[model samples]
Target: MESNQLPLRDIHLPEAIDWWPPALGWWLLAILIPLSIALMVWLYKRITRQTAIKAARKLLLQIKQDQQCDNSQKLKDLSALIRRVAISATTRNKCAGLTGQQWLEFLDQSVKGAPFTLGIGQLLANAPYQKSPPNEQDINQLTRLCEDWLNAQTKRKK
Candidate 1:
């Protein structure tokens, strides 16, 4: 056959791979990345909240154990401890600036009974102003109440 008449054609290559439609693995990875990030954020929040509660509980224990701080000082410490824990666990708007009966009511909402508003727990508001320290029994009861609150034994309204 004449060279010009040879029935041959030049090699042809396939079209270049399309970049728009990614492979299945890439699509799965795109979907999974955001989910993994969300899960990590949730876990971090949970762990930090748990850690805050644990540290606050330890501080409360120290306050309870201290023999040097008189009842007045102990009450002061306990009040501050409760406020700190509350602020950490919730928004500042929920607990900060609360005083007198309002503060007690806020606390009451969490406990099984309205202890803060109706029981020895009310002393939290007054103990700071009193000239004399509260009795040992009252202090013990109030401390227990604080412990219950920190341990989340109290019902969560949320």
Candidate 2:
């Protein structure tokens, strides 16, 4: 056969890659991106909450250690610290405006039994309005109770 008479093959290119149904890496990234964002948000919230609790605990310890404050002053400071911690760690509506038995009952809910309502913790409510200052023993018990309640509040989940 003569060279001019031979048949020739046409140049053919491979098919173009399909854009749909992305590769595995892209799919993993699509799933991981939202999950990582959600995890970060959750971690941020948890850290802030724990930080608030740690700061509150430090303040409570300082209040307990102060010797200059009299029984009445200590009672007032302890009560204020409890209120501040409760308001910060819990919903304001759940803790604020609670008084007398109601306040004690709210505190009791966090720990075992009704320590606040039935035990020395009750002193918190009456101490503020007493004719004389609370006794040293009662003050000590109340301090311990307040500290325990603070610890319980810290361990609680949202």
Candidate 3:
């Protein structure tokens, strides 16, 4: 065969295509999926903080109604409810491992100084197993402060 008459072969080049999928990457998806889930959880907790506080309020109301029950128990329950809700609403790292005045300060900081002032914080801190139960007025104040904190948290999220 003459050099000019040599058989021609079709050369196939890689198709021009986008390397990235329209959908995001597995790594991005992995990060994003967890982030989205975390965001959802945070949002859920923010919205429901009020409900938890409300439940606590109801418990307090019941405690008030039950004159026979130990006041200390009621106080302890109230404190536990608030702590649980606080832990749920914010990162455990922020609220956990906090005790005594430090825990009260944590609550104060977490709520951004709404209604939970140093006094309220102190009350909550000193509440555990106290022989003297928190009176109706004290419980009312605590409930109000918790509701305020929940409201403040919700507002911050929005």
Name the lDDT value of residue 124 in candidate 1: 94
lDDT of 1: 0.84
Ranking by lDDT: 2, 1, 3
Which window of ten consecutive residues has the lowest lDDT sum in model 3?
112-121
**C-alpha-based local distance difference test score of model 3:** 0.68
Selected candidate, larger lDDT, 1 vs 3: 1
Count clashing pairs, candidate 1.
0
> Candidate 3 residues 1-158, lDDT tens each?
78788988789899887757645676688789999999998778666766765675676567557777665666676677778877766678877778876777666764755345465646677766466777777776776676666556555542
Which residue pairs clash in candidate 3? none
Per-model TM values vs. the true structure:
0.81, 0.73, 0.57
Model 2 lDDT tens row, 105-129: 9999899999889999888887767
Clashes of each: 0, 0, 0
Please, what are the lDDT tens digits per residue for candidate 1 over residues 1-158?
A: 89899999999999999998899999999999999999998777666667778898899899889998888888988998888877767778988989999999988777788999989998999887877789888999999999988867223533
